[model samples]
Target: MSWFSPSRLVPSRLVPSLPPYSGPYPVGSCDVELSAADLPSPGSPPPNAPATIAFRLFYPAAGSGPSRPIRWLPSPQKAHFAAYARFLGAGSLLSTAVSLAPNVLYYTTIPARRNAPLLHPPGPAWPVLVFSHGLAGSRNAYSALLGELASHGIIVVAPEHRDGSAPMAFVRAPDGGASTSVSYQIHPHKPTAEVYAARDAQVRIRGWEIGVLYAALEKIGEGAEMRNLDPNLGVGGVEEDVLGSFVGRLDLRPGRVAWAGHSFGAATVVTVVKSAYYGGEEMGGPFIPARDAGIVRQITKSSVLALLDMWALPLTSPSAEQFFEKQLPAYEPGGAGGKAVLSVLSEAFWRWHGNLNDTKVVLAPRTAVSDDDEKVEQERRGPYIFYPEASAHLSQSDFGILFPWITGRVLKATEPERYLRLNVRAILQVLRENGTVVAGYSPLEGEEPLDGGGEGKKGGDWRILNPEGGVRGWLPVDMEVTSEDRRMSIGEETGGRNDEVRETEVLGDVKL
Candidate 1:
């Protein structure tokens, strides 16, 4: 008689002990913001000085019928034993108590929601898509997309790239060493005159934080250095060393993962793709000499379903040059080399000063306002007429989705729905062809605001990015995109640019 039982191969318990947590969900759909307090400066205060890095999880609604929720096959007893060891290390004496605890694994850490196991009868495990948010924004930004994916029977795990997010708080021991009780805190910049000063700081922080998350996931489930605190610690203060070890421990069964981001978050995704961090296409060309197994392998193994970038386009292209020239006059070199040279300064100064005002023109208002606008009976006449151009165009890309309020404020007016549709389609096409799960959310074309709505509403621009396009199922967008026909629009900033000559700022001098 076979004493061994086939049933022993699978663990009896299937449901995660943790209860589905639905804390106070923030009102409105996906959106981002920047204020004067977030601006960057040469001296003064530290970056993210008053910002918080945070995120939220959105699980798919329950599925029905035969095709049930996927389950991890032949659950590894060793992994469970290791988790038990970690629980012991954390100093809980009741071993049985810990084991018996309901919702132990899922609820033990964050009060987050998880989808029901296997939507129907037991089936194959669902593919997992991981998301990272834009700079200064939290994981919560992607809730709309994540929730949508979950509804379709996909399991999504969105980790807070803490460093990439707003400043976070952690616990430390008496000796100032990090303790396990680290709790997160949000220190938003105090509201002031400036719009967004810390944009770059948030970007840099996001880059480092994504790197940590990638490294951590890559190491999950491999007991090599299991003793280190990490994805294991109930709190969030794991050292890089510990994090690296934890990622190495992951049971990342082959051929089932993809990566994505929004706005600056999308840039992070590009970095991961460009560096081949999560396994993608080869990073070839002048800037990057070689390729890696990260994104390339991820695509090959996991089949990146889609790369959903909100209206974000590469900055190096000629279209971007035309866009800058046509939109921001102060950005024009006024014979300042090519448009690239001027745009760099424009971005930097925007990061620093948080507004559009030339020093020379400040002393001489005539130079700021064009002779044409002066002749016309316009109340405000300046080099560039702050219309809904840049923000309108930028919002079509991921930038708008990440910072909607800023986009609306900068652009001044909301645009049409067709524009939003075009961008969302572009992003969806790129990600799907690359072999990853993806979705692009945008506002409906020609959407009207309520009586009290429009530009005056706080975070109104956010509506433009996530318009009510009513959940369109995953129909992949056609790719063959190019910049030939679509010339960048020349906003009111035209004319006066020819007369002004501002010194160009070199790329090396600009901070990342």
Candidate 2:
């Protein structure tokens, strides 16, 4: 009878909930794919074909309508996940189970309407955010965060990279054939240079895709005919209708646009920004082809950039040098007004990478100022580093929040509400600095002062480091005083040790 109870081994209820959005407007979502024909392929000889880029758009909707059921994992994506699991050495049984029933472990419905009407009389077109997903991650993995942004009147366009970085992507043929899912293969034990080469190539293709999208948006703003600009775009797919709805509704104003990414995607953001400012070949090296200089200049001149826990900046090689030296210069304080940059890092990143020793050494010298410098000269010029104490690398995405039980094996469980509040606050600060929309709700209103003077340390577990004095000058926050050696002891209280008693006793002082 006990053996028949398999429910004890495998819990029936595993679906996780997404944190509710704290915004004013309803959210809507749509998907689109754009194709650019006869793009130059540097390494490949002749017969280079066109490039196709897929994107998912999340935006504010007109009214509160019946929400569409968003699939947690689409059919093709499930296959990709299975392949990815196997590639990462997950057991075959677990991989097959995950592939067969992804919906069983996660909530299937996303809180967004599909193809809902865009808010009409559009009170000023919404600001744009171009998001890049991490390697092997699809556009929908960050749906929770993207939906929240959209609800706050920010249009989020997430591009799905097709350069063998994504686990799988649907590639449509020009000859009207059915779309096919191409699963990217990962070569085992590749050399460091080869890995960097592959990543560089992928990032270049992503940059081009972004340039093409920006060009299309500019044309749309100029009221050019969409079909005439590219015949292959918005045709023969479900995305066609969605792309049609975006005409005349995008806000392409300079400085209002933002580019954000996580992990490898963050490297892409840095590369794109640097390439746009400097020449592509100069910033990305000889392996990378130059982009349209005009388009690159237009996009980079006024975009807010956010890098979410970027993995190893060195992965981009020469481009990484450009990012640290020329792109993110620390001597010029006024540069903030031009390209406002924000970097959000998790505690796990610091712990695993020895408190970011390499990064600190690279950035410290560039930001050091003279001790006798004037007040105005001492103003911070570099990116603000936001460190959330209880977070991990995956904290920026829904994966950590949704599957806490599984993720907790590697990292401590995060308080989703606290995490969201910290993220939203940091993002709002960057937006305000960039002169974008300011949040109606403020996080600093009723909070105690960060300095240790006010009512103790009750605010939160996060810190912001300014680059003016480099890593050594990290601002201090109120810290709670606690006993060091408070150990729990269990003892038998009753005669002859009949009953157990537990007590906590304080010993010597201990620093956390």
TM-score of each: 0.36, 0.73
**Top-TM-score candidate index:** 2
RMSD of 1: 19.2
Q: Estimate, for each residue in 1-512, the C-alpha lDDT of model 1 and write its tens digit.
A: 12222234323243232122121221111111111122222122233332322223243333222221111110233343343334233333223333454233321111232222222212333345566653333343234345444443344555554442322222223233543221222223222222122333333344434443333334332332322222221213222222221222232454345555543354444443333322112322111212332223342222232233221222222322322123211122231111110011112122221112221121111223455643321222221111122223233232233334443454432432233343333333333333334332223322344223433442222232232322232122211112431222112123343212111110011111
TM-score, structure 2 vs. true: 0.73
Task: Report how far off residue 63 is in candidate 2 (Å).
Answer: 3.1
CA lDDT of 356 in candidate 1? 27
RMSDs, each prediction?
19.2, 12.2
In model 2, what are the clashing residue pairs, if there are any? 484-510
